[model samples]
Target: MLVSLFDQERSFTRGVDPMVLVSPSIDEEMRRKRVEEENRENNSVPLVEEEKCRLQTEILGVKCSLLRMERDIAVMRIERRVEMERTLKFIVQTYLLSLFD
Candidate 1:
């Protein structure tokens, strides 16, 4: 009688315990949930990729503009240097010509 009672108790406990039963349907549902999550993540990936590409494009445009500005500044610097050299040469020539006159 004690053994029968113990067996019944074990059966009841196993029936009530969630870990005791692993149904294939439960596994399929879990797999379905995981697939759904992965699908959601995959769907968002394209938006993230697009945002990354847009940011990269904007960064490249800013870099190009900066490069253009740097080139313009360099050209202006060279032009100023040449102007100064020409002015100095004219002054020296005028002074020498006056001394001769």
Candidate 2:
């Protein structure tokens, strides 16, 4: 009974799937969409390159700033060491003077 019903349905539909009829047009449309996407990518390539250059420049600027900050930190550290040594020396000299007195 199910086989008979399936045969009747197949006869009603003429045994042709709808996709089989429209597959060529679907394939052409897919190809056209791909070409459009490729064209879009090609057009945006220059913008991508410009953005890359801009980012590179920003990176260079950041690196320079980092180097400058590192130098400043080194100078500050040296100054701090000198100040600490002077303070220690001053304390030592005061203690020595009181001992002599």
Candidate 3:
């Protein structure tokens, strides 16, 4: 039975829906589009996750390199202090010897 498109009791599935009956081809097209959209989203999720993992790994590597650089800097400071002390001691001994002469 043909019913008005605005009828509330019309079921779209049973051809009694309020909306005009959609052609089967249009329905198939809509279904296909929905599936394609879902597939694209599903496919992209793994790529996004992989990108996140790669970025995290790169960040960790940078942190490790920075830590190593800081450690090296600390070691260099200690070495410089030791060298300065040795140099000061040598200069004092030279001054003492010259005074005796």
Candidate 4:
């Protein structure tokens, strides 16, 4: 009986009061909007949590890459030092051979 009061007419009528005509539709639209907004609010909590987890994983990946780069640099430096020592020993040995000749 209460809903009947707000029930809309299906057929178009001329010169009916616009307020009475549009009121039920407006109320229903407002109720739908409110429900959608509540759903969005409820969903934001998990969205925020997912973002936090993604950031932590990215940080861990960056740290691991940095460690790998540091290890590679150290290995290159050792190889360079060994090569320099071998070149120095070859130079000294050649000089001694020339002196004997």
Candidate 5:
């Protein structure tokens, strides 16, 4: 049912005309816009690239910090489990000794 509805919508939408879509006037306008965009990009590419590099480096640093935090948490969990086991063993041993006495 959803597929049929989507098909209906697709049919209702205007299909592209090959000739008009690729007309000379349209092509010229597109070319002009593209050239303008390229000029702007040429001006800003270095700055944009520099910012992107900095952001990527910061992201890597954050990821490294997160990994270290995760490792620290894992180590703490292991230490906590060991401590609990030791405490439980001591309690059981004391209880057994009392029973014997």
Candidate 6:
């Protein structure tokens, strides 16, 4: 009978083997391995969350810095335009004076 074969601590390859037919020692080992793997996966979840938060914070910081740079560049362009206009006016005045002389 199936019970007798299992009771004798023998492995049968004839059909699908239930968990009971497998040795309790092997079953326990498998259960321990599964528990350890689950624990490892669970422990890594927090680390993944922490990394995500850090990356988001870093991205925000970079965006703020870029905005500041853009504003500074706009100010510099306005200043250069003013300087060029003044120089052009001076050149025109000098040319008119020379023509009259």
Q: Which stretches of candidate 3 lie over 4 Å from their true place?
A: 1-24, 93-101
Off by over 4 Å in 5: 1-40
lDDT of 2 by residue, 33-63 (tens): 9999999999899999999999999999999
What's the lDDT for all of these models? 0.88, 0.87, 0.86, 0.85, 0.87, 0.88
Clashes of each: 0, 0, 5, 0, 0, 0
> Model 6: which residue pairs collide?
none
**Residue by residue across 1-101, what tens digits does model 5's lDDT show?**
55765666676646853221223687899999999999998989999999999999999999999999999999999999999999999999999999999
lDDT for 25 in candidate 5 is: 80
TM-score of each: 0.66, 0.52, 0.64, 0.52, 0.54, 0.56
Candidate 1 TM-score versus the reference: 0.66
Highest TM-score scorer = 1
- Clash total of candidate 4: 0
- Candidate 5 lDDT score relative to the true structure: 0.87
Worst 10 residues of 4 by lDDT: 3-12
CA RMSD of all predictions: 7.4, 10.4, 8.1, 6.3, 19.1, 7.6
Model 4 lDDT tens row, 1-101:
44654455434366775344334577899999999999999999899999999999999999999999999999999999999999999999999999999
Q: Worst lDDT window (10 residues) for model 2? A: 15-24
lDDT of 3 by residue, 1-101 (tens): 33544454544456553445545687899999999999999999999999999999999999999999999999999999999999999999999999999
- Superposed by TM-score, candidate 4 places the C-alpha of residue 20 at a distance from the truth, in angstroms, of 13
Cα lDDT tens digits for candidate 1, 1-101: 55765666676744475333334677899999999999999999999999999999999999999999999999999999999999999999999999999
